[model samples]
Target: MSRYFPHPAYAEDQPLARTILITHVGTRAITTGTIIGAGIFGTREALRRLRKAAAPSTVTASRSQLYLRVAGHSTLWTIGIVSLGLAGRMWGREEIEWQDRSWRLMENEAQLQTDDWTYGGMVAGLAATALFKRPVGWVAAVGSVGAGSVAGTLGYLGWRYGLQRREPPISE
Candidate 1:
């Protein structure tokens, strides 16, 4: 039985499992960092845009009026950041869970090799996005890269799992 069902022991010896676990952690870290960075930088940019749009007199308005403006902007920024962070965290967790499950079930070494390339591309995309100075550009770039990577990974998992299910079982 152990000879026929050697996957458990093989998994224990394989570094792929550990690497996948580390990848999950890295994904979570990247998600958190991106969310927090976007929130802080985006809020600052939004406030700057608001100030720029205001009339010259508004810039020198009464202290009470200035305080009100600041409070309003801050409230909006806080809400936006919280919403974005929560959504990003939820999505990231789901993605990690899906990947973990997929990798556990995957037996195709070729598919795993393909995943390495796909993940490398994603990291490169993130680096490219991070180079942008503007918050909007950064957010757009990162969001697109993240979304594309998630979609591609899920698609690959689905294809592999579907193929595995369609194959006839071995009877030894």
Candidate 2:
């Protein structure tokens, strides 16, 4: 019975699993858009305020500082967003968890953990440069998080639905 749907255990539910992955991919795209939107709509004023008191500082600092600060801020923003979704563990708090299965939830939880690790690692790299008064290591951190997701999804779909094309058998 459980095989018919996405079981909440360690297993592949295929279609449903793909749906879940696509949902995340969609969600990430939306979040990236939102972050950019929010920043575009309301960052100048905030930066202005932050810079009013800091000398050798303007609304837009050097590229290196800008990268470190904004990237760091983005990391914090991600953490807050993730925390909001984690309000529900066993009881009921987070709304999204309403439909998420336990294993799926765990997998997502692990994913968040990995993201945090990545963000923190980048922070460390940036911090090291900052300590030496150098620039943020953006070059080393190329590629967005969504890149792998979209690729993985496309590959999964191709493997699942495209690799085994059917054709009529030759006449005997």
Tell me the TM-score of each prediction against the true structure: 0.32, 0.31
lDDT of candidate 2 over 66-164, digit per residue (tens): 544554455445545654554333255343334454335334533443334434443444345545344344431221232233334344445445674
lDDT of 2: 0.42
Clashing residue pairs, candidate 2? none
**Tens-place lDDT digits, model 1, residues 18-90:** 3454454444344344444445545765787888865356354443233323433433444456556655755
lDDT of each: 0.46, 0.42
Off by over 4 Å in 2: 1-61, 88-90, 93-102, 105-172
Q: Looking at candidate 1, what is the lDDT of residue 140? A: 54
